[model samples]
Structure formats: C-alpha cells, structure tokens
Target: MIRDGERVTLGDTAVTAHATPGHTMGSMSWSWRACQAMTCKAIVFAASLNPVSSDGYRYTAAASRPIVAGFRHSYRVMQSLPCDLLITAHADQDGATDRFRTAPGACRALAASSRTKLAARLRADGPAR
Candidate 1:
C-alpha cells in the first residue's frame, strides 16, 4: 500500500505522491518539477475531485464520514500543491488538452470547485437519517 506523502523516483525525476481520496479511497495525485535550462515549472497531475460513486452512496451518512473526511483533506492537499501546469484525471476537468497553456493556480481553482461540489452534494444528500 502506497502511503500518503511518499516520494517515488523514476530515473532522474522524483515524483511526490499526494493522497487525494475523493473519487475513491485510493485516489492520488502526483507532483513533479520539469526543468528546461533555467526555467522549471511545477506540474501536478491532480486526482479526480469528483464525487463519482455508485447511486447507493450517500456522503452525508455516518458510513461515509471517512470518505468525506478524505475529500476535505484532499481539497487541502490539492490547494497547497505547487502547480504551474494542471492536468486532471479527466480531460474535461480542466480542459487539459484544449488550448494547451500552462495555467498557474489551477490546483487552487480545482480544489475550490471540489469544495463547492461537495457542498452541493451534501445539500442534496439532505439530513442524515
């Protein structure tokens, strides 16, 4: 099992793994720096912040407390990442391929959006029974 805050090295590049378990219990995001001479840009392959799950799943239930906690932690992790370029688990999440430009602060935006989505889902979930 890969624990959170582990740095794995692939040849010359070391990628830091951050556990962002919103989409799933094992969801993760990878962060690394790519340098071109004097210019090094921070790249983050962010995990899917979407609350994708089965129809039977309800985030407000006591059973989902851990899941919701993970999501909250994930939001903080995503927001704190050093991201100069953004790539998400899904293409449409940030339009990773569209226009193809490095957008800083994307991680913060992604996390903020996830927070809103989670809030909406919780609202939709209604009061816990």
Candidate 2:
C-alpha cells in the first residue's frame, strides 16, 4: 500500500489493488477513496495496484510456472482498471507530479524509469565474460 498513511478500512468502501509493472520487481499503483474523482464520495474508496511478473514469486519449478502464469494474468487485469490517479512508491516519478495527475500518466512515468534502470543494468553487466 503506497499510501500517505497507514491502511484503513472505512465501511467496506476503500482500498483496492491493481497490478502495475515495468518499473521494479514489485511495482504497484493505488487509488484513494478520498479523491474527488470517484463519484461515490459518500464512502472512502481506494485501490492498491502492483506489478505481475513471470517470476512474481520464488518456488519449486512446477509451482514457479503457475505463479509466473498468474502474474502475467494479473498484469493483464491491471490494464483494465481506471488509472487516472498518479500514485507511486517512487517519489521522483508519479509522486513528483502535482497533487493532480492522471494515473495512466504516472504509470507511464514509472515505466520510463524502469526502462532507464534496465538499460543501466544491461550496460553495467556488459557482455558477461
């Protein structure tokens, strides 16, 4: 939960998850109920999103395959979620944006950062000898 404070439940109308990857091993995107965007303001509603990967978890070969498959499916699921709120763990990207920013935009920023890091890693480990 990459929220400002501790996780709290309000009348079962808060906190949700969405898978967002391409940033880190376990990248996620979240939405809060307090935000005015949500039409149902009566109740505090929020979403918690994370990245799903082929190797989301470490386990036996047989189990690993299933886990990886599940992660891939989870990633797909996040794609359909409403991503209009920019909320990220890394303050530099989405978190850096103004108080009001689109979730998809934030996600894009996260993806860019992830690419940058991946490129750097590849460069650092040039042609393993």
Top candidate by lDDT: 1
Clashes of each: 0, 13
Model 1 clash tally, residue pairs: 0
RMSD of each: 2.0, 8.6
In model 1, which runs have C-alpha deviations exceeding 4 angstroms? 94-101
lDDT per residue, candidate 2, 24-70, as tens digits?
A: 32444454454445453211112222222353332224534443344
lDDT of 1 by residue, 75-108 (tens): 8998888889877888766434542236667889
Give, for candidate 1, the lowest lDDT window spanning 10 residues: 94-103
Once fitted onto the true fold, the runs of candidate 2 whose alpha carbons sit more than 4 angstroms away are 1-9, 19-29, 32-81, 94-100
Estimated TM-score for each candidate: 0.90, 0.41
Candidate of highest TM-score: 1
